[model samples]
Target: HPQNPKPQNWTVALEKYYLSTMYSLEFIIGALGNIIVVFGYVFCLKKWKSGNIYLFNLSISDLLFLCTLPNLVNSYSKDQWAESTLCHSNRFLLHANLYSSVLFLMVISIDRYMLMKHPFRDHVLQKRNTAVVVSVAVWIGVILELLPLLYFLEPVTAANNYKCLDYASSGDPVTSLVYSMFLTVFGFLIPLLTMGCFYLKMVCFLQNRSEQIRSALTLEKPLTLVILTVVTFSLLFTPYHVMRNVRIASRIPALNISGGTQRVITTVYIITRPFAFLNSAINPVFYFLMGDHFREMLMAKTRQLLGRLTTTGK
Candidate 1:
């Protein structure tokens, strides 16, 4: 009897096209915005506050992550994985940026809440020195947390030599699922909960205050920031985590899942990935809105440059 051939998953082809397009767009938009923020911080802004320190770190993280996107875009577009060293380094930076960005966002949330609570900015954590220490600690902590991935991420193994598999697909399915679940809890869930609590408290505090107090404090800025943060998490982070865990679990042979079901899950997981990285593009909005002096200085710099260019033309 002739054997029936297994059905191929066409979603893999879809992923290459989709990711290449999304990543190319993300790299362009994210790079421009992050570069502006970084340039403004380094050149235009003179005085650095605690909040500025945190926002600057966030910009740097985004900029660094955006730098990796071009390479990723090339790989996806060509459907070719990079060499082992490049793959390892690229993936490491990607995970490092992911966790660090979340931690920095959490810090920003806490900083904003404290600013509202202690409007005069007299809290000890509001000090610039304290912010510097906290930023350093966050980088170190993210590195420690992601160090385990180095052992698990093999871009080219005996089984798969051509593709650079993600954490969910590259490593041992059972082990990867366990680690993915752990990250969802510690890396995302905890920080998300903390941000929610602080933002909720900020909202409650604002509501209780008189209209005069709200007007004087400029309630709209922080309110806008809260909305943006919530939107980013809901639209971006949540889906990625859920899909990542499910994708990894489905890969476990013990699960006895049908091939068609696995393919569907994998397609959904692939769709979530670009959204996860979309934060690099979105974080710049936070800088413009929440940064104390950032918007003003950026405008000033823009006007100055225009004036110079006009003079040069004349």
Candidate 2:
């Protein structure tokens, strides 16, 4: 009777072990992969060009977000906040880094656009100092942008354990809607549109830059990067936003969205949270995977690591 009690304290058919394993893998892969990416961009390449600097900062952002994944994994598995302050700080870092990633990608596209439009002006703003200044500004912007999230996040007990939940309990409905709309729109859609338009124009310019010059450069790459970013951004974020509202709308009896639908949406949202994180995880791989220089550096590093391992074993 007790085993088949009237109300179960926890979820059934949750695949808790499997979910925990996946989260662990996600944390490990994200952490190690991003570290390698940072190493590749910095020490291995040894080139700090404008493009390189942008990519490095992008890598750093990914690395920072990845570092937060382990804490999240632990929280998910234990279903509680091991450290409240750490959790809030991680949320801020992750959110800031993700948004900053969008800005840097937009900047990269703009840089490409500038190069395609006026290659002669490259030296004017492509200097190392210029890259450093831009990187500093991007970081500052991220810090300011994420300052709000710090206040919203608070530790609360749910499912008999403490976890970080947003301050929606006190925040007004209108305020929440406005914030969500802006976050979903400006955070994802606008930068996407800007990148798309700029890249399309850049492609047109590249086509006109004479066959020899075009052939020497991998002109298709710019469009490829745009396509990857578009797919990952849309797939990772769109549903999360939709389900978040569904979760809210469920509380209002007048909303008329069925309870069953909302439950299904919430279940799916929980199941798919990890995939949404791939938006940050996959970009660096896409950016550098096929490039000759990137591959060379990666291979050399792999061999050195292997040789060191072999010597240590001896």
Candidate 3:
């Protein structure tokens, strides 16, 4: 490609150290938080709210996604995956987490709206069975949506068979750009907009209700979820999607984008990859903040364990 006449050596060096550090930190922190939440839900909490089911699924997604990061960390640190199978599977897990996280957040937003609409909890959608069915549908939908990635994402690059290149970076630029855009629009933009709409409706609903409802302390969790979703989309997803398209577009032979410009785009795209995955690390915060029952249960469990330890020490 004339646009990228020479390899940008600095990008590789940056990715090697930067992504290794980032993924290592994310894996450790994300795994701990998600694991604790999963255990807390399973062992500590007896009663399950409709929202609890959704948050539990979210925790599962984060935990599974975090599991894949060790492979990524090893690959990035060594500059190659041990095998192509590892490459493909890890990439699959990564994309699955990304799309699934946003979709679950959208569902949570809708769930919040339903909660406010039916504080008495009589709505059909608020039923525990319905939540389970919806969660199942979300997993299946995310799987079907991401199925093409397995085919399109060539695990190894032609230039370096050992290096597992992402679809946008390794495949035919025109084709990669098309598929990336498709994923962005359907997997990200639609869900993000859906979340925004529901959040707005939630805010309106809260405001229009009586002052009793307004002062009921229900605003904190929903508002926190909304702010977190917005922040995650803006800080993490947007730049990655934008720079991915830009990076692939620069690689297309017909575009004739300058070599210098291509380097800048590629560097930025590499940077965004780690930031995008930061969601896995940060998602555990939602479990603590949004689930009142969860927080109380987890704290009680911790206190109980501490009391046991103190008695043992005595």
Candidate 1 lDDT over 40-136, as tens digits, reads 8999988888899999999888877887888888887787777878888888898888889999999998998888778788999999999999999
Tell me model 3's lDDT, rounded to 2 decimals.
0.83
Evaluation by TM-score, superior candidate among 1 and 2 = 1
Poorly placed runs, candidate 3 (over 4 Å): 1-7, 213-217
> Candidate 3's residue-wise lDDT over 236-296, tens digit each?
8998889988888999999899878878888888889988888888888888877547788
Distance from true location, Cα of 158 in model 1, Å:
5.1
Query: Candidate 2's C-alpha lDDT?
Result: 0.65
What's the CA RMSD for each of the models?
2.4, 4.3, 2.2
The most accurate candidate by lDDT is: 1
lDDT of each: 0.84, 0.65, 0.83
Candidate 2 matches the true fold with a TM-score of 0.79
- Relative to the true structure, candidate 1 reaches a TM of 0.94
Which TM-score value belongs to model 3? 0.93
Per-residue lDDT over 1-314 for candidate 2, one digit per residue giving the tens place of the 0 to 100 score = 14533222233233244445655776676667778777776668876667677777887887787777777666656655666688678777767766788878777777665655555545666677887899899899778766765655655545334555433321344455556566667776787788888867866766676476755375566556666666667777667666555555554556676645655654665555556566566766754742436768878988999999999999
Model 1 residue 123 lDDT?
A: 91
Where does the lowest 10-residue lDDT sum fall in candidate 1?
Answer: 1-10
